[model samples]
Target: MFTGIVQERGEVVALDLAPDGADARVTVRGPLVTQDVQHGESIAVSGVCLTVVASHEDTFTADVMAETLLRTSAKEWAPGRAVNLERSVTPTTRLGGHVVQGHVDGIGTIVARVPHDGYDEFSISVGKDLARYIASKGAVAVDGISLTVIDVNDSPTGAVFTLGIIPETRTATTLGGAAVGSSVNIEVDVMAKYVERLLSFRDVEKA
Candidate 1:
C-alpha cells in the first residue's frame, strides 16, 4: 500500500522488451527511492506496483508482465522517460495524500493543460465506464500522485475531470511535464469501489 506521496522522479535507464513481447525488464534510476530498497520490495512506479527484481545503489530493475503493460501506459516506456517513484509506506508512514493500492484501473489521456499563476490545471479524459466512480472534489491518483478532482464533466462518449496542480506537484511528479494527449495511469478511490460493491449486494438482498 501507498499514500500517493511521490518520493522522487526517476528516469528509465533501460527497457528490455521480450522478443515474444510477453514481458519487459525495466531499470530505473531513482537515487532517493532506491537508497534503502531491497530485492523483492514493492515500489510504485508511475502508479503501477512493481516488485524489485534487483536493487542497486542508484537503480533497480523490475519486470513488467504483459497484463500490466496492457492495462497501463507502461507500454510506451523508453529510456529517458521520467516516472514518479514511491517506496511502499511503513506502519509509521504518514498518509500525506490518500490511500493508494498501486493498482492502475485504466489509462487516461491529458486533453488540456492550462497554466495560471505559476500553477497548472489539467483536464483528463477517462473511459465512460470508469468515470462514474470519479466525483468532483474526490481523490484520484494520477501517475501515483494524489490529486483532487476540481470538476467532472460527463458525456456519452467519455468523462473528463479537471485537477489543480500546484508548483510543488508539478515539480515533484511526472504530471508536471505531462503533455496534451499523454497517457497516465489512473487509480480511483478504492473506498468508492468497495462501497459500490456493498451496495450491489444490498440491492440483491432487497430484491
Candidate 2:
C-alpha cells in the first residue's frame, strides 16, 4: 500500500527483457535512494508498486509486468524519462496522502493547462469507460501524486476533469512538467469503487 505522495523523482536507466514474459528489469536513475533497498521491498514507481530485484549505489532493479505497462504510461518511458517515485509506507509512517493501492485504473492525457488567478488548473482526459468512476471534487492519483478533482465533464473528445495544482506541487513532482497530450498513470479512489460494488450487491438482494 501507498499514500500517493511522491518522495523523489527517478529516471529510467534501463528496461529490458527478463527471464519471464511477466517480468522485466527496470533500472532507475535514482541510485542514492535505492542504494540500500532490501531485496523484495515494494516501491511505488509512477503509482505502480514493484518489488526490488537488484540494487547498487546508484540504481535498483524492479520486475515489471506487461499488464502494468499496458495500463499506465510507464511503457512510454525511455532511458531518460523521469518518473515519480514513492517508497511504501510503514505502520509508523504518517499518511500525507490518501490511501493508494498502486493499482492504476486507467491512463489519462492532459488536454489543457490553464493558469488561473494564482493556481494552475489542468484538464486531464481519460477513456469513456472510466467516466462513471470519476466524480467532481473526488480523489484521484496521477503518477502517484494525490489530487482532488475540481470539475468533471464529458466532452466531444472524451471524459475530462480539471485539477488545481499549487506551486509546491509544481516543483516537487514530475507533474510540473506535464503538458497537453502527455500520458499519465491514474488511480481512482478505491473506496468509491467498493461503495459502487456494494450497492450493486444490495440491488441484487432486493430483487
Candidate 3:
C-alpha cells in the first residue's frame, strides 16, 4: 500500500525492451526512494506498483510486464522522463495522503492547463466507465501524486475532472511539466468502489 505522497521526482535512466518479445525493464534513478529499498520490494512509480528486480547505489531496475505497459504510461517512458516516486507505507508511516493502492485504474488525458496565481488548474479526461467512482472533492492520484478533485463533468464522450495544482505541487512532481496531451496514471479512491458494490448487494437483498 502507498499513501500517494510523492517522495521524490525521479528520472528514467533507461528502458530496455527484450528481444524475445517479452516485458521491458525500466531503470530509474531515485536516490530518495531507493535509500533503503530492497530487491523485490514494491515502489510506486508514477502511481504504478513496480517491484525492484535489481538495486544499485542510486537506481533500481523494475520489469514492466506487457499488461502493465498497456494499462499505464510506462510504455511512453524514455530516458530523462520525469516520474513521481513513492515508497510503500510502513507501519509507523503517517497517512499524509489518502490510501493509494498503486494500481492505475485507467489512463487519463490532460485536456487543458490554465495558469492562475502562480498555480495551474488542469482539466483531465477520464474514461466514462470509471466516471461513477469519481466525485467532487474526492481524492485522486495523478501520476502518483495525491490530489483533490475540484470538480467533475460527464459528457457523451467521456468524464472530465478538474484539479487545482499549487506551485509546490507543480514544481515538486512530474505534473508540472505535463503537456495538454500527456497521459497520466489515475487511481480513484477505493472506498467509493466498495460503497458502490455494497449498494448493489443491498439492492439484491431487497429483491
Candidate 4:
C-alpha cells in the first residue's frame, strides 16, 4: 500500500520489450527509493505497483506484464522518460495524501492546461467508466501523486476533471513537464469501489 506521496522523480534507464510483446523489463534510476529497497519489495512507479526483480546501485529493475501495459501508460515508456516514484509505506508512515493502492484503473489524457499566478489547473479526460469513481473534492492518484479534484464535467462519451497543481507539485513530480497531449496513469479512490461493491449486494437483497 501507498499514501500517494511522491518520494522522487525517477528516470527510466533501460527498457527491454519481449519479441512476442507479452511483457517487458524496465530499469529505473531512483536514488531515494532505491537506497534501502530490496528484491521482492513493491514500488509504485507512475502509479503502477511493480515488484523489484533486481537492484543495483541507484537503479532497480521490474517486470511489466501485458495486463499492466494494456491498462496503463507503461507501453509508451521509453528510456529517459521521467516517472513518479514512491516507496511502499510502512506501518508508521503518515497518510499525507490518501489511500493509494498503486493499482491504476486506467489512463487519462491531459486535454487542457490553464496557468495561474502561483499554480496551474489541468483538465484531464477519462472514460466514463472510470469517471464514475471520481467526484469533485475527492482524491485521485495521478501518476502516483495524490491530487484533489477541483471539478468534474460529464460528456456524452466521457468525463473531464480539473486539478489544481501547486508549485511544489510541479517541481516535485513529472507533472511539471507534462504537456496537453501527455498521458497519465490514474487510480481512483479505492474506497469508492468498495462501497459500490457493497451496495450491489443491497440492491440484490431488495429484489
Q: What TM-score would every model get versus the actual structure?
A: 0.97, 0.92, 0.94, 0.98
| Clashing pairs for predicted structure model 1, backbone only | none
- Give the alpha carbon lDDT tens digit for every residue of 1-207 in model 1: 999999999999988999998889999999998988899999999999999999888999999999998999889999999999999999999999999999999999999999999789999999876898899999999999998999999999779999999999998998878899999999999999999999999999999
lDDT pick, better of 2 and 4:
4
* Ranking of all candidate structures by their lDDT, best first: 4, 1, 3, 2
Candidate 4 per-residue lDDT over residues 1-207, each given as its tens digit: 999999999999988999998899999999999998999999999999999999999999999999999999999989999999999999999999999999999999999999999999999999988989989999999999999999999988789999999999999999999999999999999999999999999999999
Residue 3 shift from truth in candidate 3, angstroms: 1.1
Q: Where is the poorest 10-residue window by lDDT in model 1?
A: 169-178
Local lDDT at 192 for model 1: 93
41: Cα error in model 4, Å = 0.5
The lDDT values for all models are: 0.94, 0.85, 0.92, 0.96
| Candidate 1 vs candidate 3, TM-score winner | 1
Model 4, 120: alpha-carbon shift in Å? 0.3
Better of 1 and 4 by TM-score: 4
Best by TM-score: 4
Tens digits of per-residue lDDT for model 2, 143-196: 899998998998665688999988888888888898889988889999989998
Which ten contiguous residues of candidate 3 have the minimum total lDDT? 15-24
lDDT of 3: 0.92
Expressed as tens digits, the lDDT of each residue in 79-171 for candidate 3 is 999999999999999999999999898899999999998779999999887787779999999988899999999998679999999988888
Q: Where does model 3 exceed 4 Å of error? A: 20-22, 203-207
Which candidate tops lDDT?
4
